[model samples]
Target: MSELIPAQQLRYSAQLLLPEMDERQQQRLFASKVLIIGLGGLGSVVASYLAGAGVGQLLLADDDRVSLSNLPRQLLYSSAEVGLHKVDCAKARLTAQNPEIAISTLPKRLTLAELQVLLPEVDLVLDCTDNASSRLAINQACYTQQVPLISGAATGWQGQLLALKPWLGQGCYQCLYPDWQDSPSCLQSGILGPLVGMVACQQALLALQYLLNIGVIPFGHLRYFDGLQGTSGQLQLQQDPDCPVCALNE
Candidate 1:
């Protein structure tokens, strides 16, 4: 792994010395590639941490642009970045934060076909998109590709995270939400500015842990958090024996 990444001095030194995560874990993160959808609130934070930790490649995808309203929470963008493509803005900020990171910008919407083209090359998929339709598409793609998916949502101080390791014994995202109903986007409901960053950064932490092969998986369970109350917790993970995807595979 050290041979894979020679830029030791550029980044990853502090991570190697961290108590639970050793040099091996740091090297693992350095060698991994991750794809993040929607370079907005969640995606911005996710990109920051992964690049900061020195993920070898980042497939940054988003078709939106920074707007005046986005400046409150989308730290990757500034007043100057408004009207610029989200992926370009994100790439500029993330690359400047760590020049060693290999970041690619795809400023386009993710159709099922487009997702299939991208997901296979990525070691892991992080869904930072705002809508449930996009989330389910990402989930199904990962399930088919045998890739792990890290998903998080935040709106108005409430947020949750769920991990779908399809290749593992755990169930995929659709298995957990089999009904497949569409949910309200943050724009519709009006999200709290800072909470988006919190949830996104948390998702990034879990992503890094998974890539580094360190923390325990939150399979079949959801971790919920409320920033207004300063509270957080996890709920039980129930496997559906009749889940269309997981059951058939099992």
Candidate 2:
């Protein structure tokens, strides 16, 4: 591992102060690479935290453009960037937040083949996309590559997070939701701004822990949050023996 320069030491001083975080851990963070899909509500917060935490390289993928409607939960953009592509706006903001890290932008949706090609170089992936198709695709790719994945979602003052480590021989996102095709979206159910942030923060925290090999990660577990009631819960995810996705891995 490369030694932390004076600049890095100063920049990551807060993290370095943590008992579990020393120069070596800080250096590990600097060496890590993360791919964040969807530059929407969840993705925006996850990207900001990971970049600010000094992740070495960030690959941002999102084909959608910013809009006035995104302003509520997607704090990464402003009114000035409403018409621009989300990845472009996110790249600029993330770069400005931590110029020390490298940001790569993919202003398009990725196909399965494309994800396979990209997953090998990535250490972990964050599935911040709101749709089920995107989530299932991401889950399949990460499982195939044996990469850790952190998936999150929020709607109507509620949020949920799930972490999957394919190599751990646990349940995947597909196993948790076998029939993900006809799920309701934020557009129909509506969502709260802070609800997304809360979920995103948890996703980011789980990613950091997985990357740094710190605390125990709830792999194959679904964590639920109810902002309206100020309560939370968790459920252990079960792998389906009949799951087609899992059969592919076998």
Candidate 3:
């Protein structure tokens, strides 16, 4: 950990002013590494905030290309980038946002084995994928590596968030959705832009808190946000006795 340069101090002065944040915490954020899967609506917001906040290293993975339909919420891409790979576009945008941090791009979906290999190097992970298969795979890998995970989803007028600390043995994502079934994606169900951003911001906020050791983040709890009503609620999660993914950990 090196001292914060004058430029960095000025750039992050707002954060340093917080009682929970100081030069040491700011340096921790600068040295931390985060892996984010999916570059959709949620991924877009999470990646942008983490980058802007000065996360030292970011691993971005998404195989999809930017599409015109994505503009509504995937703010990382533009009309000119509609056919470009999302990871590439995201890398460019995030790098341009903060040239100090390092960014790595994986332009394809990762298999469980791939995630297992990658998770060990990451300090934390953000599961921003929209499907059950991707989310389950990420959860399994994070649990195996004993890394913290922040998972989020949004579709139609609803959004969900979870911060899972696997080593705590509280509960894993599989425990919440034992069947590993996912609802229709935003593509089919239609999503409001702000609805997804709300969840993404929560996901990013939890990540920052976890990394900086600040505030009481609700790990192992499911947070639900109703876009239409503009209200949110939370439910504590419990590990299932029969949850194959996390049962062996107990």
Candidate 4:
């Protein structure tokens, strides 16, 4: 690992102070690469936190352009950026926030094949996409590549997060939502802005923990949040014996 320069040490001084995150762990963060799929509500927060913490490289993928509706939850983009590609706008904002980290942008949605191609280059993947189909595709790619996945979603006043390490014989996103069908999205069902922010922040925290190998990994479990009630719960997940995506790994 490359030594932390004086500026980096000062930038991450608070994190370096944590017993579990010292100079060595800070260096690990600086050397890490993260791929964030979807530059929406969840992706925006995940990208901001990760970039601010000095993740070495960030690959942002999102084909959608910023819209008036996205300004509420997707905090990375401004009103002036409306109609601009989300990845490009996010790249500009995140770059300004942390000029030291390398920021790469994919101004389009990724096919499963593209995800497979990119997964190998990153240490972790964050599924910040809002749709089930996208999440499932991301899970499959992560499982195939044996990369850790931090998945999160929010709809209406609720959200859920799960970390999957299928290579560890754990249940993947598909195992949790087998026989999935199209579900109501934020556009149709409506969403609470803070709710998405909270969930995305949790995803960011889980990503950091997974990357640094600190704390208990939340794999094989789901964390659900209810913004209306302001409460949360956990569900332990089990691998399906017949799960197509993860059974082979087992």
Candidate 2 worst ten-residue window by lDDT: 241-250
What's the C-alpha lDDT at position 55 in model 3? 93
User: How well does model 2 score by local distance difference test?
Assistant: 0.89
Instruction: List, residue by residue over 125-182, the lDDT tens digit for candidate 1.
Output: 8899887778888877887788888898888779988887765656666667888776
Tens-digit lDDT string for candidate 3 (1-250): 5788999999999989998889999899988999999999999999999999999999999999999999999999999998999999999999999999999999999999999999999999999998889999999999889989999999999999999986677879888889767798788998989989999999999999999988999988899988898888999998888888887445
Say which candidate scores most in TM-score: 3
TM-score of each model, in listed order: 0.89, 0.96, 0.97, 0.96
Better of 2 and 3 by lDDT: 3
Which segments of candidate 3 are over 4 A away from where they belong?
A: 248-250
lDDT of 3 at 10: 94
lDDT of 1 at 187: 73
lDDT of each: 0.81, 0.89, 0.92, 0.89
Per-residue lDDT tens digits for candidate 2, residues 1-250, read: 6788898889899988989999898878888999999989999999999999999899999999999999999999999998999998999999999999999999999887899999999999999997888889999998888888999988888889999885566878888889877557777888888889999999999999988999989888899979999999999988887777764346
Clashing pairs in 3: none
User: Who is ahead in lDDT, 1 or 4?
Assistant: 4
At residue 228, what lDDT does model 1 achieve? 81
The per-prediction tally of clashing pairs is 1, 0, 0, 0
